[model samples]
Target chain A: MIILEDVHYTYDGIYTALQGISLQVDDGERLAVIGANGAGKTTMIKHMNGLLRPQEGRVILDGQDTKFMSVAEIAREVGLVFQNPDHQLFLDSVKKEVEFGLRNIGFTENEAEQRRQKTLASLGLEGLAERSPFTLSGGERKRVALASVLSTEPRFLALDEPTIGQDAHQKNRLAQMLAEMNKRGRTVVVVTHDIEFVIENFPRTVAMAEGQIIADGSTNMVLSNDEVIERCSLAPPQMTLAARAIRNVFPEVGQRLTLLSELEETIMGILGGA
Target chain B: MALIEFADFSFKYLGADSLALKRIKLIIDEGEYVVLTGPSGCGKTTFCRAINALVPQFHRGYVAGNVYTDGKNTRENEVATFASVAGLVFQNPENQLVTLDVEKEIAFGPENLGVAPAEIRRRVEELIELLDLEELREKHPHEMSGGEQQRVAIAATLALKPKVLVADEPTSNLDPKSAETILEIFAHLNKRGMAVVLVEHRLDLVARDASRIILMNKGRIVADGNPREILAMDLCEEIGVGVPKATQVYKRLRTRGVDLRNVPLTGVELAELVQEATSQ
Candidate 1:
């Protein structure tokens, strides 16, 4: 479990990224963070892994203060995949890149190799095992970065914009992988601008604006509120918007829908009634 | 004649085994707004690089056919000459930033082409007004957000007064509203008679503004036609290109025996369509 209490952070003591932010995430919870650029989404995620220390408040992990723990020590329990794969990829080959984290966290040579192979295959990166990291495409590089973090098997995984450059197929594959990981008792927290991905996968969402948590609750409620979405500079999923449009005429469809199948069924029912 | 033409073009990297682009044929007329899309590693980037002669000039790839811009062969003309004809904006905003302040960065391209100081100042002011860069005039690229930096990049490329602008995944790093704002800038540019070639995966965002959509797969053109006709086909979803969520809903309703009159691209249109069908 992770707990944050009135956390405040300032870069160079000039720009404040987080302002009195407080939140809690239980073990095995899947959370999604959504906001505009420079809204402190990345800064808050950094505190979870001890990359950035708070200037005023406190961040606790499993009831322990994170101020005394080193980044390397905190990383054993929390793994963060950066938004840009180029910032994290510097190794020669994909195999070495995935194995580096395992070896750093004190895994044996044989065990690290076994886990690396499994993670690579899971992300469909086995074919690029021997290829140079710089030669891969943007989407392939993103998967390799995720595979490296998955090999560590940390209890909490934090990913920044995991669906940025991915297509429909790749996005589906990632959603399934993260769902499986969440089922196995690992917490998954993702920060993204992909509203559709959030509506489909993440049940609990937190929206930030100007360095403060503005809305936090079920994805359906927070995303459907027009005032909250406008104040936060966020555009809801297209399906959700369409559902609202349909409700304008049919008034009977009360709930906010985020899936196309549900929208189809609702429309068919209305047409049949006519 | 088309402003840009690819006649039987094929290219391969210096040491790579297979060709990155194979026997591709395409054209871009004057003032056309075209969107190119496909799966990852499907040669969309390779095709964009061939526009300003970056494939064989900077990347040192082997070329097999002719690429013409304004009736001049890309291989025959100097890369510097084409810099004033075609402006390229890369994926990452940080990679394109070279100057300290936003104003100086916008003037860097025109400075390189030896424009007069007064003319450069005029262009800077014009673009600042057009792109809303006045508030960020003194801010450096490293100090701004991703969206701000991308705006600076676009303004910098526009300072060259290029006739054609080719951007690869410009909105991949931005929020939805910021992405829409950027595409609206492209629409504004297209209205002023500047052709645009955009390589992106989000068809739902750009399909409404684009006159044509070109789909590629494994180094070959799979589909090329009008945006509405291309989007209505089943090949897009089958090949991994995501259609709009509303399009998916419309397609499902059609399969379930709903006779929709027109295909809608935006969510509002889809909603109105459902209301019309039910009210009747």
Candidate 2:
């Protein structure tokens, strides 16, 4: 479990990035943190892996205080993938990049190689194993960065903008991979601007604005709230908007429909009744 | 003549074994808003680079056939010479922004083109107002948010008064709202008669706004047509282009025997169509 108690962080002693943020993530929880740029979503996620220690509060990771742990120490349990893949990827070969994380965390050479190969194949990066990370396309590089982090097999995985450069197909594959990771008892926390991905994948969501948590609950509930959606600069899923628009004709239809299947069922029901 | 034309174009990066873009023959006329889309590594970025002659001129790639911008063959002219004909906005705003502040960044293009100092100032001011970057005029572009920096980059690109603006996934780094804002700017610019060629994956947001949709995959132009017609195709979904959610819903409803006419691109349009279909 990860717990943040009234965490406050200020950058350069002036810009308050996080303001008294309090949250908790149970083991195996899938949580998404969303907001506009400069909303401090990244800052809050950095606390999970001790990348940024709160100035005024405490972050507890599995009953241990994160303040006492170095980034390398906390990384054993919590792996963080930065928003910019270039920031974390410095190795030559894609295979070596994944192995580096495993080796650094004290994994034996043979064990690291095993995990590295498995991680690469899982992310569909086996073909690019021998290629340089720098030469890959943006989406490919993102997966390489992810493979590097996933190779370590951390208990908690925090991804910052994992869906940014990915297309629908890559995004679908990533969603499936994250689900598999979560099922294996890894807690997943994602900070992203991709609301559609959030609605389709994550169950719980936290909406932030101006360095504070404005709303936190089920993804459907939080995304349906007009105030939160507007304040966070989030574009609601298209189906939700369409459901709301046709509410007068089919008042029983739920406006929180985020998936095509849900909307299809509602429309079919309405057509049958009509 | 077309604003941009590619004739049997195929290109391979200097050391790459296979072609990045294969036999892409297309014409983009003036004032057209074309949204190029496909899965990652589908050569959408390469297509955008070809418009501005970056593929062969700057990247030093093996090129076959011709790309003409503003009726001038790209192979014949310098990359700098095409700056005024086709402006390319890169994916990452940080890379394109060279000046310390927004005002200078906007002015850099016109200045490099040897435009008069007075004319450059006028263009900068006009672009600042046009892109709603007035508040950020004096601020450093690197210090601003991704959206703000992109706006500056677009403004700088516009300062050159290019006939067509080619943005390579300009909104990839932006939040949804900011992404919408950037697309809106492109739409607005297109309305003012400047051709806009945008490479994007978020087809749901742009399908309604674009005049034409070009879908690419495996270095080939798989589909190209009106947004409504192209997005309604199964190939769009099969090839990994994100068909608009509303369109997806419409298709699902159609599969279930819901009779609907005309593919809807937006939520409001879809709602109206459903209402019309069920009312009868």
Local accuracy of candidate 2 as per-residue lDDT tens digits, B2-55? 998999999988756578899999999999999999987778878888888787
- Name the fnat for model 2: 0.78
* Model 1 stretches astray by more than 4 angstroms: B276-280
Model 1 in CAPRI terms: which quality? medium
lDDT of each: 0.87, 0.88
Q: Over the stretch B139-234, how does candidate 1's per-residue lDDT look in tens digits?
A: 878889888899999999999998899999998888888888999999999998999999988877898899899988778999999887887889
Cα lDDT of model 2 by residue, A17-104, tens digit = 9999999999999999999899999999998889899999999988999878888788888999998899999988888889888888
- Interface RMSD, all models, one decimal each? 1.4, 1.3
After TM-score superposition, the amount by which residue B198's alpha carbon in candidate 2 deviates from its true location, in angstroms, is: 0.9
- Give the poorly placed runs of model 2, Cα more than 4 Å off: A107-111, A252-256
Error of 1 at B274 (Å): 2.9
